[model samples]
Target: MHLNRRHFLGTGIAASALLTAPTVWGQAKPKVVVIGGGAGGATAARYLAKDSGGAIEVTLVEANPVYTTCFFSNLYLGGFRDFESLQHNYDKLAGGGVTVINDMATGVDRAAKTVTLAGGQVLPYDRLVLSPGIDFKDGSVPGWSLDAAEKMPHAYKAGPQTQLLKKMVEEMPEGGVFAMIAPPNPYRCPPGPYERISMIAHVLKQKNPTAKIIVADPKEKFSKQALFEEGWNKHYAGMVEWIGPDFGGGKVEVRPDAMEVVIDGEVTKVDCCNVIPGQMAGKIAALAGVTDDSGWAPVDPATMKAKADENVWVLGDSSAQGDMPKSGFSANSQAKVAAMTIRGELTGSKTFPAKYSNTCWSLIAPDDGVKVGASYEPTPEKIASVESFISETGEDAALRKATYEESLGWYAGITADMFG
Candidate 1:
């Protein structure tokens, strides 16, 4: 069956609906410390508190008061969503009796199982859940680093970078070149840069119809390539160009100061450049000693618990689970399993068998959306895909529109799931 948000979330398939524990007033509640406020952490934190009914003391340590989801950020550029709509607060989670802290977690002492914050407070955890999102690999892109972000924004993390990239695209001179250096594989949002290109094209197609987009991608093929290419051709013909590694797309560099893109040693001046370098798990996961040499935390596929420490669980973009893409939906799915397992271990709560699912939706144009998804069962080896589905290339307009509408509902439902 094609699982929509209603069936996926409402049916308790995404998370266990009955996560109850016998609450005791005289007892010390088990404490769960969740780091990062993205899909994984937020969902885990919310579910831990909401279901535990005061049996688990959930303290969420997030650096930001408002979370700007990277999922729907592309729509903001396409004029489909406003900036404020992408931002969500912890009000619902707080109302559910969760202690939400806004502070950076600087270090983790694994032996002590304590997280040290930037503000000098050390938090102890019976269970530590780290769902910190992706962080760029230093020097992954030639001549591009975090310092050069202002000149050539990656916009990968959302928030100010998203707004900056939008402003840069809007302010570009007519017919100017909008260049993008796509990240390599194993990056966040497999089809993100492409969808971003489409959204940017959507904006430029209307405001700066003469603007040109050049994509230098390391991979020859991308997720939903046919769908995106078809839409680009049908909607924004002659306005977009994609260069793959076969065409020296991989041997590319950016000169942020000069606002230029060097493709295969050939220099081209660009009005705006979006440089997305290779990525790895966020810094906190590495600090916690949960991540492997690959910079992603390896976890037991069955429980989403890090192999390094059973007391710790990793979720979202930081986890090296198999098959599932590093998407918000996947993270949210994984968070539920992790949360339930932790609750069972800590509070002796009712536990359910682990089931996971994910779907990634990309909008190629206004009301034109495509998606790929799968349901999973965890083996000792990996979280393997048992069933899968994708939008067909020749799908009708009504289907595409419906897919887009489904994505919107998913956004609404998922945000409610995470923060509430």
Candidate 2:
């Protein structure tokens, strides 16, 4: 079945309603330290506190007091949503019994089961959950690094980068070129780069109709390729060009200072550049010694337990789980399973089999949305997709509008699920 808004919301709420655990007595509560405050960590931390009912002490360690969701951030570029709408706070999580710490976790002494924060606090955890999301691989993009982001933003992480990219787009010279260097495979949000292209095209179409968009993608094909291509042609005709590796799209370098792009040794001056480089699990996971050489933490398909350590669980964009895309929905689904397993292990609560589902919605134009999703089950090798669905090319406008409406409901429901 499709993992629509209603189904997603129902499953999440049902998971929380499973059972109230017996409170602990005459003993210190088992502590769970959750790193990162995105969909995965936030939901995991909240669920552990809510269902365990004082049996498990859940502490969430996030650098930022308020989280700006990477999901739907492209819509902000398209002017479909305001920047403030993307930001969420930990006030509700704290009210829900989660110890929300606003500090950076700089070190993890896994052998001692302690996380050292930059503020000089060492938090002990019976279980450590890492959902720290993606960090760019240094030197992944030649001539571009974190320092260059000020000139050519990689709005992949949202917040200031998102705002900067939007500003650059809005301030572009008339009929100017907007170039994007897309990431390689296995990146967070498979269709993200393309959706962002569509949203940027939407903005350019309205503000600077003659502006051009060029995408330098390493991959030959992408998720929802047909759907996005159809939307681009129908809505932003003659305004977009896609250069794949077949055309030297992979051989790319940027001069952020000069605002120039080198594609296949051919130089092109661009008004704005968005460089999305290769990515890996956030640094904290590697510091915890759970991530493999691939720079991603591998987890058991059944429980999201880190393959390198029994006490560590990896979720969201950081985990090298199979089949499921690194999406907010996927992270949220994995968190529920991890929360349930942790509760059962720590407090003797009833545990259920892990069933994961995810849906990724991309807005191509106003009221024009497309999605790809699947339901997943764990096998010996990996978490495999059991069923899948996608919005087809040439879908009716009303259906696309309904799909967009569904995404709005999902955003409201998911943020509530994460924060409250």
Candidate 3:
């Protein structure tokens, strides 16, 4: 389990890789360990190494070698994209001088400032960035547990579960019922469930037009609600049904064994069920003692540094910073600020005022996209929204198509920025 000098340097990279930390220089380098390789962690790792120009040793710890992006998994379900198009590997990060380790972080010793991997390798770090994404809150939904995921797939983390959900949708019997148990607010990707509904409807429209999709939501309103409703009526009229909290959307339970969903004490048989439970910061954040009582990690709005631990920074869906939603764009924006602050503290790199931005784009159907976004700055109390914009309902098809294309460009640019 010991990572000898040679093995540590040569295992995931070339013998002459810059990830070796300039051992010949006879000076200790500040080691930065980033746990999680999603939008936030990967970008933080890449920026830390690139902006530092090899002055610091950066190690990225990820549980998966290839990431399946949850942001656009809906598109894959709609058949607009393939699974391969959604996957990005870590070889580019490894080649770019980051010590990319495909390992799960099991524990964090704060006083010792060391991270323990599931394989028993311990990594010492001057600073740690934790962006492990979201995990379902225990018992958030009655009769649903992680053990029940295979039967009623959440598909919230992407990858295999996404494929499972898609397959379930595609294999639905003619005129079968598809049901979704939407999560509450303050969860990752505010517009994700609705977009998912649109994609599933798109699939059913083509494969089984008589099939029906149902959404039992706890919230009275959702992101882009007006736009989504308009699109649903225009594109998939009478095929999709949304029951809000006023109609007892909040009271729901599922019996995965019988493939039944209970809304407001009324049981209905469903051919497929996607039970998205409440969420919290990833397990590693709690393991590291960074999360607060709210089941999320609180961070300084200015620098994304963990309020509980100065040596730690939490990003993405794991962070409960004020005002910013837990989207990939928000995480990427926060990571840049945190990366700059870390560089400034360790390498004396000049730091600027922390400003962040995020834009979440969703596809209603093929060539129809809508978006919501805002610019923000760190205030004394929270990260406050500055200026905001959203796509209005009834926009021209050309504009919607343009918005979808814009999102495609962002995906390409952000992935390149994160991976390389």
lDDT (CA) for every model shown? Answer: 0.91, 0.93, 0.92
The alpha-carbon lDDT assigned to residue 341 of candidate 1 equals: 97
Query: Highest lDDT: which candidate?
Result: 2
The TM-score values for the models, in the order shown, are 0.93, 0.94, 0.95
Query: What is candidate 1's lDDT per residue for 1-420, written digit by digit as tens?
Result: 223522543455223434444332223467899999999999999888877888888999999999999999999988999999999999888889889999999998888777889997887788999999999999888999999999999999999999999999999998999999999989898888989999999999999999999999999799889889998998899999999999999999889898989999999999999999999999999989899999999999999999999899999999999989999999999999998999899878888889999999999998899999899999989999999998888899999999999999999999999987
Top candidate by TM-score: 3
Lowest lDDT sum, 10 consecutive residues, model 3, at 9-18
**After best superposition, candidate 3 residue 61: deviation in angstroms?**
0.4
> In model 1, how large is the Cα lDDT of residue 382?
94
Per-residue lDDT over 189-220 for candidate 2, one digit per residue giving the tens place of the 0 to 100 score: 99899999999999999999999999998899
Where is model 3 more than 4 Å wrong at Cα?
Answer: 1-27
Ranking by lDDT: 2, 3, 1
The lDDT of model 3 is 0.92
Worst 10 residues of 2 by lDDT: 19-28
Off by over 4 Å in 2: 1-27
